[model samples]
Target: MAVHLFTEWSKSPGHLDHWERTGREQGEECGLPNLGQTCYLSAVLQCLYHTLPLTHYLISQAFKEDVVKRSPSRGQVVQAAADILTEMDRGKPKKGTLAYFKGVCGRMDDLFAGSGQREAHDLLSSFLTWVHQDLSSSRNACKKCGLEPERRSTISDIFEGIHRATIICPESGAIICSIHERFWSLSLPLNNPGETPLEDALQQYYHTRAIKWYCHYCRREHLCHRQMHILFLPKVLILHLNRYNIKGSDPKLNWVTFPTEELTLDGHLTPGQKGRPWSKFSLYSICNHHGNKKRGHYTACCRSNHPQHVQTPWLFFDDEEVRPIERFKNPRDAHILFYIGVSQVQQESRQTCLASGGMGLQ
Candidate 1:
């Protein structure tokens, strides 16, 4: 009987095998159609899809429930967007998803309608804001006290940072410290015209500056040194290079060199927080802008997660075309960089801290 069953199973059609092969091929080369001037949207979506944890969260059942329970109207847009991306991830591509996303955007704002190119950074900001508003839950238990408390939303904090202000009085040698805890992204200014390293740019951001200060303690004015510090570092770090200056519309076409592997932030972490030691991240995605101020194109390069590959593969997405690239041809055009936590211990610690209701700039 066993032999007979085995013979019949072996003789059955290879439909399952064929389907698996087809799915693998499709998933390896999935691309989004250029819906008019929606390349900005496409670039952002591709980058988001590459963020494995975010993709997993979006496609999870929890996200579906949160959307329905929250704002159903605006939530539907996020749901639709997530659903479309989920389908693509499952190797079931839908061209109509782009259309649906566009329709939702149009209904939400008039600025996103029609075939006009928009800034990719602005689109990412709006998308993140919408997603954060809809899916964020307040019921997460605190890891320390084991009680639910009024805390910062996990979704928002994943991308948020702290801006610290320090004032010093020269005459009395008095010092004051203040912290402003909210920044979605870090704006890094370039020094040279052609090239700047990521570390250098970050150093420039936290560099000390001399400012005129009125010391209330001393009741006098004095020249004081001021400095900014990163009070909180998010699990996913998004760095935006300030290429477009206020002087003119022209963008700085300088090559901003960034680490392709590990990005250590121990030096940038807040003083007390530095003892925790979870300041390393792995580069995952990059959004590059081509052309100048008048007219430009957006493209994204993302790390591909395939079990067979020895080294992580980086694939370039230009509109509807997807191709594997050894390295970014033009690193200067890199406008947005995404990095995710790589240390498991650090990740667990962060989760524990968030779960314990210790969610803040510590």
Candidate 2:
């Protein structure tokens, strides 16, 4: 199964067959026997990559449940597995330790301590350190203050970091600048710059070759660039409404209604707004062109409009260029540096997307 998932069977037919026949010979040699385990771990890490809601302890217990249900580990193996997962959940496990253990168990060594246990322990230790280093980025605080109190001190950050790390290969120096190229083309709202970190969040991708690219909206990383898609407002609006209660009374309250005019085919690109005095929903505008001369026009209230006109044309639509679903040709093309820096709110879930108006990129 691991071979099937990871290997390009059609591209390397006989090679896959050979590996499958030998039962993951390469993985075994690399100390990972179970491709399924690595796949599972990768999926979990990616899920947590989006947002980690469960506590480390709870995550460990969940892993125990999964492994125990599959194997007749009596309580000993279950307990040991739980311990290993616990260390991983708490960011103490080494790089790929969970997947490695899943691969090496029963094939390479025993877990009853001694050399086998020591190796396992070392793996877990290394994983944990990596998790800490990657996820635990330090925020600068003033000499008199603990400014980064809102930072999430958990393993999720590391997962995101790791996901981001894939695109960067120091050895090859291969890069894709897709995000950077579309930087001006895409419209996004800005937030307080002081609260967001600016370093290499999106900058590193400026020119590095990326083996895989994650869709920000879907939370699935390691995706082919061609598979990427800009989010449409309708779905994004729903997600925001459900998550943040967009319509209900709040300080950020703004009305976002559907279009009275027919939808267009060509999408619009309204410049994103920054600072206050502007509703968050008004930040970016995306209108699909419906092939009509007046296709791009939609209801909207500008500063000059009175309350009645505001309500009348409050619904805005757009018609601009639609970005193709392509792998960022270079890292800079994917560098949402300004957007990320302006929008990163430490207190909010990292995965949470802000609500935009009708015909907007949700």
Candidate 3:
């Protein structure tokens, strides 16, 4: 399959230059036409587009090379995504990339076809899997030895973590432990019945759990414990709240209070690792769902990098319409939240301002 470049559109007499100039003048608020019931996908895309590292990577030459190397025939989703990012960066009107993305998604799953409304989390998982397939690699070696190139492969380490399971024998008091790396998004359960704080939910997620198991070390049945810990911090952190309860068909609308400025993850890290003392992150975007499971609307709010704004800026994207907001007063409907490291925010802000030609403040 031949690769299609955004430059192909440059043939239309200064279209690309005009788009760039307009974007520099006005803040980027490129909208997307709703492809039937693709609001979920659109919301996910909006949040991901606001992710600085992800947006930068998608438009980078390395991403294109990786797409060609990993997915030769089925690279339309990625290609379309990149084109959308480019168009948005240039401050162009909505060109509608939903058709391309929907086509690829339908090929993967039947539920994604037509005007059927799918879960945002499910679509996000599929999209991330497709995009980050060949973006990372793993190394296998002993504690003393260095990396083993033979075991290396494409690996995205942003959401990676380790799951540790420990088994203790009741009779002999012997203990057995095992640790393994996990590459996936973290789903935090709303265990508490009433309103819960985001930090409290995270604590519950990493809290140790005891269960009955057979201990191989002492060859006897005993109690076992399992815990999860962060292996390393990623440039962008995505957290999905599991709101739907199995017992009750209704979705949990309980308020999940999350930090707007900073979230430290020092307690979740594994011991003896040389990772940062505290993984601090600042809110960048939020994917919120309104109404119930059967009928609902998906919308997203992203931190705006427009240099002209006096106060902190945020834009809410509802399908083809975009509007600015001060901040999220109520976070009850916040389903998926995106955060980036504080250290990188300043650099990204500078890039955003430079890209926009340093527009005058209002």
Candidate 4:
């Protein structure tokens, strides 16, 4: 849609008034996908108009056509556009809009470059927490899926839905979040940096210890597809897991699974269980394309979908200090939510930024 609009607009050599109507007609038929495409392109057009010093006719046409027509005039889309162009002098670029994009890109670059160090710092924090606490029970084993139950009972799980957890860029503190229940937890070691790099220490810890040397993707090593799996067990059983610090601000934890469409849980595990695990059992399903040659695919319960002993635990932030200003109770304390993260691509975009001169590595 953007390409089509750009092509048409670029060719139309008439006055702004003449082309404005044409673009509107085009956008009307474009549908929702086209609307998004136009908005993104409009942002770029906005940048180019200001920087390149286009003629007044061109600028006017772009705004009235791209900005005015596509904008819904009610929700955030139009409002934000209006806010950006608030101080728009006749025929000039909007100051607010330019500043907004520039700030976004600049901040993104800052985080991407410093991400490695920030992850290292987070590892230190995780290590300190692990060393300081003397857990009553260290191993809660689940024979079916080869996971430990003890680690699943941390504040991250206990207070799962209270307040949303944040998944910051670790480097820039820039945030990207998903729904609370979709977060994913991976185990990696921080204190004992035997082989893995300091930055990925925590991930390594999770892989080695929590996964029990099994591969989550292939399941050859008896590892579940994800480090964090929802298991069904009896209420009387208590889980013990290793505590790991969260990296971002988006209430959701980082984990993987395709959209719910191609994936689902078993009957017993279908209507997920809260505190009690044994009462009901559900099958955890995943669409994994990691090792397969056939693009990506979904991998469901080839084995058991229960928690294992000596598993990694989740950690939560948001005590009195991080709580919202409102007087309402923390949401995490009330609902039953899972911690999951977006896919690798989404996580990376939320995490890294690149600057012009140097290649930013995070």
Candidate 5:
């Protein structure tokens, strides 16, 4: 049954049977073994493994000191992740499993601890938060100021971005105040997905609006213009299409066409960011949900930038099965989109396409 899906996706019967994908054959990573209902975890692990920045940091073993300094129990999540990523990178035992990482995650987070299934985005979010917390330096409040220090780590540096909203008073257009907030992902409003394009959604995100403000600068209750802009861009940008509502609303299944090659943020950026180099991102990975919240299963389709994976440029990861995907063609199931920063020189070649026929090689 599952084999049929892979066949249709690859459009090649012999592709999945290739011996190289089965084991650790230098530079080739093995499929993650999903025990019955562990497809969500398997998909998440595969997506994270292909995240070059995070995977590189893990394989580089920069977290060794952080692991050693903390209590053995507190450091297990990142350590476990590092172990699993390394195993995937170097390959081992024909396939892969995340027993240790799952165990550690189950221990720290109740979502994975239960016998029942968990959502992929929830699981991914938790894993990143746990790793970031473990690697961050601030565990306790400052001794002198009694303030909890800001948590900082390479994880934050890679995945986080800052947004600033400047409130301007109507009176003489005086600057009221600037509010800055850090975010790991961009949550889009799906209230009206009927005719919204990706660029329109992005524009709405940084849109300027009017608000009733009692600004100290104005010293009165007057209309103030509130404008928001991206203060800082992350190396990896995540767009979380808010499909499932916590209040039990129906999930938005409408498809919005998004640019995979040049998702430029110049218009949404502040004047300050213009001074910096090209502020754009190219699509890297996508976590697609197949069904509704109750019965949905997640799968990841990642764009491989690594030279070794050029042959299989677009790889589909469904549970333990990995194969070349025929085409993306504006995915309606796109839930989480991962975008990576690219320079002007790097953006010259826009191979934003899924593989088709045979191996889908260059």
Candidate 6:
């Protein structure tokens, strides 16, 4: 908690010039204009824009084919998304660029219902869900029974993860629950953000917690242990630190030192259940939130793959303003962290020096 978050308003002379120059060479550096309290929205989109594979898919309009195959009704949202991203890619970051995206989302029953301040994590999850539903092969069916065989989509293939929760009654030796589901992100607790480490938070996430429950088999209340397991890991991993406590007005402030290079989940996976056979990830993007829930600003620090700037392939995105970031390895107020498999990182770096895509702001 000794560390303080870096606000976007603070700046110095251009230092990561090499990285910025590389970004300009391989991709466009666009900034988003903040419309009212729309900084949260821009922050998340910026992170997604820098996601090379996603940019390639959406910009190429590959998702349209899936939309056609699935249903015509869903194409509207996908098309709007494509249009927004494409527009962002072709233009520079500035004010009034997010009209299309805002219009579309606003029309969706006034997305987020009505908002002055919105949660980035919620917006991200909702957007991904919409995209996944639009592209998925099936809308309803059993995933475990093979009833819906080809249910995957670009969104599912990239961001989705498989998790299984097992709960056992210690005294009765009977099961109270067993559930499995897909996850788009991992929400970690930050009760004491100042003192919590990234690894410690993760451990708490997968740790078994004891709960009192009535065991039907035992006909009495027993202390049950609930444990979560990772059956599969996604290509792009999103970790959202749960900093907002609705009961309180303020959000968590202290920063947690995370693994900027390589993060391994060798011990976290279910035994013999590594669906993707890859549990190692390397940090690539960060969505840092500054201030509290009432008034906060979001910024993104992304990894750039310019070979010449190997020592510093990182860029800071504050809406439409793009700059080189020398010290992105540890962001003090990183609310959400993005990571990709180490193997995939190597593959992407070799295949593409930079990726092109766009996002909206303000």
Point to the candidate with the largest lDDT: 5
The residue pairs that clash in candidate 1, if any, are: 142-355, 142-356, 142-357, 143-355, 143-356, 143-357, 144-356
TM-score of each: 0.78, 0.19, 0.78, 0.17, 0.79, 0.78
Global lDDT scores for all candidate models: 0.65, 0.24, 0.63, 0.24, 0.68, 0.66
CA deviation > 4 Å runs, candidate 6: 1-27, 68-73, 91-97, 109-115, 139-151, 172-177, 213-221, 249-253, 305-312, 344-362
Per-residue lDDT value at 202 in model 4: 26
**Residues 226-279, candidate 2, lDDT per residue (tens digit)?**
212221111011001111223332212221222211222112211131221111
lDDT value for model 6: 0.66
What lDDT is obtained when candidate 1 is compared to the true structure? 0.65
TM-score for predicted model 2 compared with the true structure: 0.19
Q: TM-score of the candidate numbered 4?
A: 0.17
Task: Summarize candidate 6's per-residue lDDT along 35-86 as a digit string, tens digits.
Answer: 7677788888878876655765787676767885344334665676677666
Q: Report the lDDT tens digits of candidate 3 across residue range 1-362.
A: 22111211112221212111112233356667787777898898888777654565565544665554445235666677777776666566354456776777777677787788889998988877666543433456524222223232222434433444445555665656655555456788775566888899899988887777777875766667665676556545788988775456455546588876557777786666544322466677899998777779899988775322223467889988888775456457898988755443444554476467653222
Shift in Å, residue 313, candidate 2: 53
Please write out the lDDT profile of model 5 over residues 172-253, one tens digit for every residue.
Answer: 7889888777778888866664655789878877788999988887578888999988767777788877667555655654
State residue 9's C-alpha deviation in candidate 6, in Å. Answer: 35
Misplaced by over 4 Å in model 3 are: 1-27, 68-73, 93-96, 134-155, 163-174, 306-311, 344-362
Clashing pairs in 3: 136-154, 136-155, 137-155
TM-score of 6: 0.78
Model 3 C-alpha lDDT versus the unseen true structure? 0.63
Each prediction's total of clashing residue pairs, residues at least 3 apart in sequence or on different chains, is 7, 55, 3, 60, 0, 8
After superposing candidate 2 on the true structure, give the runs of residues whose Cα lies further than 4 Å from its correct spot. 1-65, 71-78, 84-362
Instruction: Estimate, for each residue in 89-194, the C-alpha lDDT of model 4 and write its tens digit.
Output: 2223344454453333224344312212122222222321221121112445544334334433221222121112223233233333311232223233223212
